[model samples]
Target: MNKLRQHSFLAFLCLILILPTLVFGECTCDEEEDGDRNKTEALKYKLAAIASILVASAIGVGIPILGKTIPALHPDRNIFFLIKAFAAGVILATGFIHVLPDAFDNLTSPCLKENPWGKFPFTGFVAMVAAIGTLMVDASATSYYSRSHSKNNQAQPVENGGDEEKAGEHEGHVHVHTHATHGHSHGSVDTSPTTQLLRHRVISQVLELGIIVHSVIIGISLGASESPDTIRPLVAALTFHQFFEGMGLGGCISQAKFKARGVAIMALFFSLTTPVGIAIGIGISNVYKENSPTALIVEGVFNAASAGILIYMSLVDLLAADFMNPKMQSNGRLQAGANIALLLGAGCMSLLAKWA
Candidate 1:
């Protein structure tokens, strides 16, 4: 009888422990059902944001591509130099002001452990590495292509009988420019076609890489946020962001003179990366913790690398190349105009940082 009593007591204790779980499980189910309803409501906002994103993107990218039709916007026009300069300034500001700071924030977030990340500025270090790597790639690529071009030129003899007629007529006066990067120069007119083509190819590919990296990141970040208020402004800013960036990229592509197929492929790639990123964010929104360590690390690293590439490309390839030209140096008014444009571009992009 005493053992029987003990068994009853044990069962009573188990019931007390298990009863709360059973009650809590029902509450959990109700909460989950409510959450589903909330999520469904949230979808309405997301769809609107996405639609706005597409429209803004279309406007932004279309303008630059259409600039070819505008008389003042031709690549050879003097205004084009100033426009490119302004775009370069915008890119530079983007690297330094926007992306780098965000990277620092991410890498130094409190969520990340303190031992390694907090000890030093990983943002700057990663950016520096990326910049150095870009330089190496830029130099090596130019060398490889230039060498191959030279070899091809050598193999194919010049037309008009070895081009032996009247060297003085075209000597150093053909409106020919090198645009050769990384210690390469266009010394001989005997082989300019190959050099020009190669330079354009390099510029187009590099520009795309830089722009696409930044765009996808911003797109996903915008899409994944739960706050509708935040998404609204970003929709506008990012639209303009893509437009200006598209213009910059379009300028490079236009200069590159790519084939129809190549141009379309590049344009489409630029357009899709951000949208794709947004979709990815939406799909992963359930498990994607914005404040999580893994998310911070990946985002921080990519931002740093992107910051480096844009900084280098803007300063070396865009600003310096155009600013140092005889045309710009000779015309004070044009120089002033370009400086103003630079400020405008930088200001526009800087303001957008609030949302995106």
Candidate 2:
């Protein structure tokens, strides 16, 4: 009887250990299956995103360019001012609400080593340095072009200014003197059409660079995600995000009035960047871990830099230039309209942040 009882107790102990092992093994297999299924679903959503975003970007940018054919949408028209104001607001919100926060999140992620990343506010520091660098580039470019154009203006006679060559020379001198005085007084003001056009070109190109950086980062992120639920909502959110951003870029491009070939190239480049980034992400997804130290640092620094460029361009080049214009200041109705449009643009972009 005693031997039988001891044997029974040993059997019970074995059962207790074996039962948990069997249950855990079954759970591990189920988890593996679920992970595979999620990856498959995510791929499908990523493909859909590439297509939808491409279409949305094309339409958004095309609208402003096509609007140039309409009289009311002319750059000089009041309606154009309102449209530009709205676009500027969109850019502002993108920098502050979308890009800047992402930078902070990435830089401060718990996955990074606490010694360096956690010890310093790298995001803010990088962003501030980037902003200063952009300002330097902006000022230097403007000054160089201004001087070049001023020299050309001095050397060449105005077509309608005078008759005799001596009169032309006198007129050129007078014009140069006047421009120099104006520039000195206003601190880099150039009212000539040629100079204005050059500024627009520079602004458009720089703005595109800023937008493209953020676009590519976001695309890679969406593509690398293995969660179908996360990718699904992002598809819609990013579509709107790209559309509005394209509109902002389109407005600048239209104002620059690039030749047909140039315009097409710029538009095509903007439209393709995100899709290309997605492809890259998909190719590397198997090896790409978002929480890795290298990934966090790279994404965080790039995001911070892009945010700086966009914020500077939107506030200094776009909003300030337009809002402080004599035309806007002189007319109360136009001012009100532009203000409303700006708010609406910003609010729309900010709302999209909920999903993206």
Candidate 3:
């Protein structure tokens, strides 16, 4: 009886030792096979995403440009204000709902060290700095252009000014050179057509830069992921995402009134940015690790900066400029329509955050 009991104990110990190896070995093999399958499916989805996103972006941007032929879509028309309001709302939601949270997640990831990343709110700090920097650039550029334009106007010979001065002198009144008459004022606010046009051009370019930065990061993330389950819904969400974003950008570009060559170049560049980013991700997927410290920091910083720029542009440049306009403020119906459109645009983009 003693020998039988000892033999039973020995068998139990042996089974315990061998069981883990057998289970773990089978799990490792299964995991390897699943990883391979996931990679294959991911590549197929990535290819499809690139094609679909590119087409969606092109169509979205094209709509605004084509709308130029429609009388109601003219910039001076009330309906155009509604469109701009909606586009601004989309951009605003993108910055607040989509990019800012991602920046926080990346900066505060567990993969990073706790010393600097965890101790301080680097995401908010970086975004604040970026917003300030954008303001500086915006002000500086506008000031510089205003000065240059003033110089050019001053240099031009005023053909009829001499006659007016003579006539004023003969009437026993001192001739006051009021630049307002020439549509270019030296002091006070200069709301001339030329100045406004230049401002639009600058705003459009800056807005594009912000949008492009965010688009690239998202594209790379989507491309680098090897899980079809993750990529599947993103394909649909991002398609809608790019489409609305393109409309916003297209509205800005149209307002800038660029020449044919410039318009085409800007349109094509915006259309291709996401696909190009995806292609880059595919090329570097073998070596790129999304959770690596370096990748996290870079992506986090860029996303924060982009969020700042987009938020600032949408609120200050796009919405404020139009919403505060005398025309929009005076018309009750137009104001109501614009407000409704803005709400709809923001609601749609915010909903997309669930899937994206």
lDDT of each: 0.75, 0.86, 0.86
Comparing 2 with 3 on TM-score, the higher-scoring candidate is 3
Q: Give the per-residue lDDT of model 1 (tens digit) for 1-356.
A: 99999999999999999999887756778888877766665566667666766666566555556566787777778878777777777788889888899899999999999989999999999999988888787767777887775565446444555342322124322212223322555466434655555665786688679778877787778667765566667666766777677767777787776777887888888877787777777788878889999999999999999999989888876777677766789999988998888888888888778766
State how far residue 146 of model 3 sits from its true place (Å). 1.9
Clashing pairs in 1: 60-243
The residue pairs that clash in candidate 3, if any, are none
In candidate 1, position 154 carries an lDDT of 47
> Per-prediction RMSD in angstroms?
8.9, 5.3, 5.9
Top-TM-score structure, candidate number: 3
- Candidate 2 wrongly placed segments (more than 4 Å): 1-29, 155-189
How many clashing pairs per prediction, in order?
Answer: 1, 0, 0
> Worst lDDT window (10 residues) for model 2?
167-176
